[model samples]
Target chain A: MNSLIRFIQRVSTTLLFLVLLFLSLWLYISTSYYQKAQFGRLALGLSGRLAERVSGIGQYIRMREANIGLRQENVALKNELEFLRSYITLSDDKTMRYSRLTLFDTLNYSYIMARVVNNTVNHQQNYITLNVGRCDGVEQGMGVVGHDGVVGVVLAASARYSVAISLLNTDFKVSARHRPTSTFGSLWWPGRSYTHVRLAEIPLHVALAVGDTVVTSGHSAIFPRDVPIGSIVGYEIAEGNAYSIDVRLFADFRSLDYVYVVRSADRSERLELEHNFSPNAND
Target chain B: MIKQLLRYLGLAVLLFALQLLVFNNINFHGYVAPYIYPMLLLVLPLSLKHWHLLIIGFACGLLMDVFMHTLGLHATAMLIVAYLRPFVTPSDTSRAYAPGMRMGFRWFLKYALLGILVHHTVLFILEAFTFNNLSITLLRIVLSTIASTLFILILEAMRVNGSER
Candidate 1:
């Protein structure tokens, strides 16, 4: 015991240094492919029940806002139905000809409702827990949107709960476009703010306005084309030839409570196309 | 002893819940974030066995990890912090020891800063594992360290005030 105490006293700092080095290395090695999807599902189930019970006490505080949201959603859905009616003949002909269709098959808007069970907003990479899971047809790679704008993508799902990778995370990347010209670029969070994202790799010639709309570019199957992401708050040209844009997100993260998980019906076929053309497509 | 254990357990629950729900939202200009949960680990008894301290700290961090969805960042940081805590703390047998002790601001500041530095360095590096932007990683370490220390000091002050006669 005396010898052990002496050893710890002598080498504790060095030992700690080594231990930290090892753990940091391990975290780096396993991060990209290390997904605990099943664990997330079970955790979601437990947290869902717990959040429900706890939130029940404060449900009254949120009732009014929720009601307002529902009424607005109803109005939006009605308008969407009216728009679809205007395009029903074209959609019918397109649907009959194309055996495989995508959610972006048309400019129509559809949504998958989900409740926020657990949420963390103050991390470099933040994730939200949703009550809808695989049982509710929620799947990985689907986009999650709030009433205002893009929330995140479904990273993992279990039977009763799923995990969303928020737009605020540094690890999250999306193909986005500016309105009017429809020029393409990538949208990513710099992990510095909840209200903005850094739009990368746009050419300097692409015209941009301070309040121009940023929407999903439809380059991927996760989100449909023209789903609102944010508005251009500002822009700066890098030392290189690219224009970096600052987008102010429409989602008020502090008041975020509900979301819609968007799944493309043709996810597998679109993935197949990208896989065939690309050298390393499996990621 | 059982009652005290229950009290601490309840406190742990409250800390974790509050940290996730309330405190996580209170980002002060994206530079400072309060880490009040570590107080649960900090206030643990001084006489605990070294291995036990390591285990408890691991569990404490694991709980936080489960909520944050980062598998091992907090666990790894907390373990090292726990292992090194006793040495950095004012030794009871040394000249710095004061009996019937209330650890003052200076001592708490030094101790908490050291621990936060260690924790944030490991965490930020782990998050930015690719060495993509070493400067940004360093910035995170400094910013998070300052934030956590501020949190620890504020909580300590509040505790001292409430307990003072």
Candidate 2:
């Protein structure tokens, strides 16, 4: 017993290191999947406020660039409004049940406006912090988009703040199809180049041209279909007869200031159907 | 003792604010972020208990993980470097330096860079979680190490020159 105690005392540093390594690995794997634990929520609540204040200071310095981003978004929104407006027909007849509801009456998705309090593009797995959360109708898996296009999906949220997995993150992939022929592929971050991502799994038979637009397939309940993602800039065929495409993203993640968190009201309904097919469908 | 602890705590909070607010927003392309928070562990006194160092490592990393939404990845890497730090560091018996005391330039650079290397290696590996692109991950580790270590050394030099508070 005495010898065991002596040995423990002699090598306690190394021992403590192993012990700590174990504890840390345990803690790491637990949160690797982004479970909304209490500690994460509390830490985010505290740091989110501080970051919000600090970023507010930088907001002044970049007001011009920020204004451009906002204006670009406004122009995009205006264009969308123009497109939607074109679809509406003026009917003075009494039988028309409520005029001016044609374009929006079938919208299964609603948007929650939020400001980007914090953002990053450097890490392999980057996350964006938003100034809105559960109380504001932001939830896990909600899609966030700027004026240009997709920003990311909500990872977790607190009462007043939320963190989202940026499209830059490797773990995040969006199903997209070329706008011309609707050839589908998956978009990946490529772990480098903030402005470009590699669109993988494109079959060689699918005709792809430079400047081809990539938009969401709407196959997943996370995001709506036909949402613009990026445009094809370059591509090369792999040895296995697959096209590795380089896409120029429309949304500038580095300068994200304002975004809208949107979720389909039918998301639950879609997932419920999958759940019937597979009990662990959500997982 | 309480005053010193308070000072250390204040520095931790300040560095964290700088990290989350300024550094987090600065990314030279992708996979090249300067991680300055681990410097808190690097500059601790040699005489401080190793267990205490481990605790601080976990806390610093956990704080970052919480804010960044990586869960426990940072904490794990922080713990690894903190545990290995004392072994790799030069022996400092009879020196009696304070925890945050500025060191000689050459020695400080070597020490900080070593710690940053160890920390970044573990961080990028775990962050990658899989050896999918070994080359890119290694490049990220090395580049981030240089960037973070250089930033820390400059910060330390400034502190040493400006009254060493």
Candidate 3:
């Protein structure tokens, strides 16, 4: 009995090492699904505060450009609102029966403004750090968009900070479609250029052109349908498979600052249907 | 003796701050950020018991994990390096250290590279975590390893120069 105790004592450090390793591995496994360390919440708060401070420093440098961008966005939103009002009034035809559908019945996308606190663009699987967290209504898998189009998806979050897996990353993939036909394909970077991504799994017969617009397919919870992702730049038929189209992204990540975090109101319901359709994809 | 301990502690804190605030923000050509914090583990007293080294290494890695928000990636890598240190040290052929002096820079570099590689491998694998594409995974690992080793080498040379001054 004494010898056993001695032997156990002799290897206790090694035993401890094994225990810690297992514990760490377990934490990692669970975090991949649900990282509940208030990371998102913390990240949001931290980035929000940082953005406020940094904006002060940047105000003098980029004042005129910021004003112009804001003015352009204001004009665009006003135009959209005017169009919506005219459509509502014009559709009041008594002969045309009411569909009993409201705008709320459609996919309603809400945007939460966030600041980029720590961003890395030049990485294989690059992640951008934002100054918004769970407390700021930021959550994992939320889509981020800038002035031009889709930026990335939120991967992890803390109390005041959040990390986004940028669309530029080779590991990032999303279901996208060309604007007019609504034909869908996978969007992924080819690791060769940040400005371009390869849209694969497209059928060879899908008519595409250099100036054709590509948009989100309303497939993932992260983005709504028709959110402009890019335009078809070029395409080629693979050795024995589908056509691979090259897409030029509208958002230049190097110059990104303010972004809108898209919150899908019906993400859970859509996800359930998606899971039922693609059981293997859930893993 | 107390001042020396205080200095090491300060260095550790400074490195961790730099890692979280500066180095992590620097992204050069996809996978080229330097990790200089492992130098603290590399230069720790060779005479210290293996158990103490493990504990110190674990703590150092935990510090990094806290800021990066990766719960255990750094900790696991650090423990591996610390556990393997004793076996590698005695075989290393560098300056014959008198009783109290630290291990020579060359020896430290050799030992630290092993630790850095182990850390980088674990980190890259954990980051990937899934078997999506074999070629991309291999490329990431190789690129990160090369960058990490270069960073470690530069830091070692800097340390030696600092000591000389």
Candidate 4:
């Protein structure tokens, strides 16, 4: 008994290290899906607050560039609005125009403005922290977008802050359509350049051209349809009959300042119905 | 002893803040972001118990993980470096490991490079969680290690110069 006690005491440091190592590895592996752990939530809140305060300096310095981007986006939106108005007025049928306006009003998505507190593009698994959270109607699984295009999806939301899985993350994959052909495939980051992502499962038969745009397919309730993701830059044949195409992203993740959290009104309902149809459908 | 402890604590806080605020945002070609916080473990008092070293390593890494949203990646890597620190550190037990007048420049550079290499290897590999893209992973590890080593040496030089006065 004396010998056993001495042995245990002598190697106590190694034992403690093993225990801590196991705990950390478990946290890393398990939290890959969603960081729902209580400690994770608490840490996220604390970090978010700190990052928010520190990022203020950066935000102020980049205010002019962000303002210019916003102004350009405003002009583009105004042009789109003008085109829609002319199309409505040119329609000879009054009832058709009224129904078209009603269709626009009944769109299910709403946008909530949020300031990015912390963003990482170099990491294999990148995450962006935003200042808005549950208190501001941000929730898990909601899609986030910048002024230009798709950003990421909210993974977890504390009361006052939320963390998003950036499009640059290897773990993040979104259903996207090749705008020219209307063919759909999965878009994911290849852990390389921050400005580009790869689109897979695009069949070789689908005619693709350089500079072709890629947009969200809206197959899932997370994002609305037709949100611009990127434009195809290059492609080569992969294994089997598919083509691996590289896409240049529209949103500049390195300088992201403001973003919008997309709240889909019927997301829960659609997800619930899909879940009921198949237990593993959501996954 | 109490004053020394307070000084170390302050250093930790300063390094942590610099890592989170400045270094984290410097993504060079979207491949390398130097991690300078590991210097804390490299320069810690050599007399600290093994258990204390391990705990401090884990805590520092956990603090970084919390802010970076990489929950355990940093902690695991930092802990491994902490465990291996004694092996790379100078055999003499009387002094802390730092690039100073007493320590040879070559020896200190070797010590810092080895520590940063191990830390970056463990971190980038585990974060990748796969060997499918081995080339890119290796590029990241190599680039980040070089960048981190350069930063650590510069910081140590500044520290040594300040103390000489």
Candidate 5:
């Protein structure tokens, strides 16, 4: 014990240096916004690879359940596709056909399939790491969605991996429309539950009911219009003249396995146009 | 020893206040903000124990981090400067090496300049956490280092003159 003390004293300087250095670096990387994202990008790539391998085993076990879900989704998509095809063919007027065509043509959105290698729902600012990245065209600021609904936005992307700020994060806010009322409000997680988010800025007079559907407003380029956000489950009068409505999200964040990164073809063009004209546009 | 401790405590508080309140807001073109608090570690009594210096450096940095909201950046840089202080200062054991005490102006300049450079480089680099903008980062480091060194030299000159009076 005496010899140990002497040894420690002999190298206390170096020991202290290493200990303090580690502590400071940990604090810096975890807290600072810029460093946190950079560190997340590097750390996510390594940890995401490990997670992907581990989840691979879990995926095999859940294959039957996943197959059932995929089949049901496929049937629903096929029905919707058939309906759209019939509607387009039945419309005889050229102006009506061209207007509908413009809707699909102007959207110009693409989806990149990715596996959710790592996910968290408990942290104040939770992040999900995907198995796809810049090489797969998953850039930062791209929107991410699950099979059920809206998921998150990509925060940083590396060569082989990308980290996204989950919808559960307090910092994440999305413009959402009340489907029944057509009223717009900002949807944000209140850090209470993963399944719940609060939709704010909805005026008090707007008729809100339980189970009323909510969706993306498409005011922002990150997400497309009508992407399911959640449905209203509860509400209360906010401090101001607005109603803060609680929404039950459709995406089961706890069971997330696969996701899609959304890329709008004209995102840059639209953003650049807004940047040039909008006086308050700040990147 | 107790008196020396109190003196440094007072100096630390003063420098912390000045750095947080004044120097931190003096950003020029969003690239340069002179950090003068490092002078606290630079001017510590040379004979102080190494472990004490390290602790003081860490605490000083942590305190700055808490105020500046740059959690570990300041602490890490300050700890490094503290560890490297002895190596850069004059090696003579017979005389005190406190700034302007017994060291020559040239020696003090070299010591302060090296310490500030080390502190600022570690700081800005850690804050950036990426080399993607190497040019901008280098520009910030060079500009901040010069500003900080100039501030330290001016403070040291004032201290020396105050003592003479």
Candidate 6:
């Protein structure tokens, strides 16, 4: 009995270390999903207050550049609005009927403007933080896009702030299509260049030219039809008999300052339909 | 014993504060950022049992993860490094690790780099949660390890130099 006690005393430190390590590892595994979610909510709410304080300082340095971009965007939007007005006038009867059907009916999607407080383009799973949050009606699974292109989907949100898993993250994927041919593929980051991504599962026979514009497929209702994704830079036939094409992303993730969170109007209806189709499956 | 615990507490807080306020904010064109807080675990008194070392490491990492909103990533990396620390701490038993003692720079570099490398490898892999782009992952791990090791060396050297003067 004394011998066993002596042995126990001798190895107690090692056993304790093992216990601590195992406990921490379990904590890590369990928390990787749930705690990241819960902590992200609490952290985005409280710590994002501090993140805002820091980004408030950064906003000053970015003001001049932001002004230039906003001015350009303003000019582009004005041109688009003018073009729409002229087009509507030219097709007066049909446009009037369409507007009458939808007017005061329902918006297909609406955007909530939010300032990006912090953004990272370098990590394997990069994330972006926005100044607006649950208080502003931001919710998990909502799509976020920049002025020029798709950004990412919302991962978690709190009262005062929110975090989105950026397109640069390995965990993120977007369905994209070649503008000319409408051949759709999956867009993902290769985790190499911050300004680049890969479009996969595009069949090899499809005609793809360098600089061909790519846009969201609209297959999923997350992003609306015709949102610009990027342009193709190179292509090669790879495994699974699909073209693995490199894309030069249009949105400059490094300089992202403001973005829009899109709230889909009829997503609930679509989800309900899908749920009814397969009652046992998760939506 | 209480005094020793208090000192470690102060040091841990200082290290965590520096990491949160300074190092994390500094991104060098998306290539490198020195994670200096692991040095807190590295330099804690050698007299501490391995159990204390591991618990402190877990807490320190969890704290960092909480602030960053990356819950488990840092904790996993730190736990491994802390568990392996006593095994890889020193080569020359004469000087071993006095924490404040001036050890040979090369030996010190080798020791610190190993810890940083181990920490970074686990951290980045779990952060990506995939091995699809092994090259990019390797690049991140290597660059971060070098930057962090350099920071650790410089900090340790400064402390050692300060005490002598």
Q: Candidate 4's residue-wise lDDT over A1-283, tens digit each?
A: 9999878865997898899899888878887646632345667777789899999988879999899989998999899999999999999899999999888887769999999998888888888889998999988899999988899999888999998889998888999999889999999998989999999999999999999999999899999999998999999999989999999999999999999999998889988898989967757
If you assessed candidate 2 against the hidden native complex, which CAPRI class would it receive?
medium
Q: Judge the docking of candidate 4 as incorrect, acceptable, medium or high.
A: medium
C-alpha TM-scores of all predictions: 0.80, 0.90, 0.73, 0.92, 0.59, 0.86
lDDT of 5 by residue, A35-136 (tens): 456555655555567667766776777677667766876898899899998898799998998899898888788999998876666334557778998999
- For all the candidates, what are their Cα RMSDs to the real structure? 4.7, 3.0, 5.5, 2.7, 18.3, 3.4
In model 5, pairs of residues that clash are none
* Best by the DockQ measure: 2
lDDT of 5 at A271: 84
For residues B36-69, write the lDDT of model 1, one tens digit per residue. Answer: 6777777666656556667777778766776677
Name the candidate that leads on TM-score: 4
- Candidate 5 regions exceeding 4 Å error are A1-35, A94-99, A280-283, B1-165
TM-score of predicted structure 3: 0.73
In candidate 2, which residue pairs clash?
none
Estimate the lDDT of model 1. 0.73
Give the least accurate 10-residue stretch of model 5 chain B, judged by summed lDDT.
Answer: B20-29
Runs off by more than 4 Å, candidate 4? A1-10, A36-39, A281-283, B95-102, B161-165
| Model 2 C-alpha lDDT per residue in residues A1-283, reported as the tens digit of each score | 9999867864896787787778778877765445733456777787778878877987788789878977876898899888765555445553453545743565578889998888889887888889998889888888998878888888788989988888999788888888898888888887778899888888999988999999988888887788888999999987688999999999878888878898788888877888889967667
| DockQ score for candidate 6 | 0.45
DockQ of each: 0.32, 0.65, 0.34, 0.55, 0.13, 0.45
lDDT at A178 for candidate 1? Answer: 88
lDDT (tens digit, per residue) of candidate 3 on A1-283: 9999878865997887787777767765666422523343443454445544654565467557656666877898899989866766687774332342354457488999987666655445566778787889988889998767899888777666677878877557889987877888888986645688888887877777888999999867888778888888889997556888889988767656778899988887888888888859758
Q: Interface Cα RMSD for all candidates? A: 3.7, 2.0, 3.7, 2.1, 14.4, 2.8
Which sequence of candidate numbers ranks them by TM-score, best first? Answer: 4, 2, 6, 1, 3, 5
Chain A TM-score (model 3): 0.76
Q: Write the per-residue lDDT of candidate 3 for residues B3-72, one digit (tens) a residue.
A: 8688679868767655655565555555454566776776665556768878888877765665455667
Ranking 2 against 4 by TM-score, winner: 4
Alpha-carbon error at A20 in model 4, in Å? 2.7
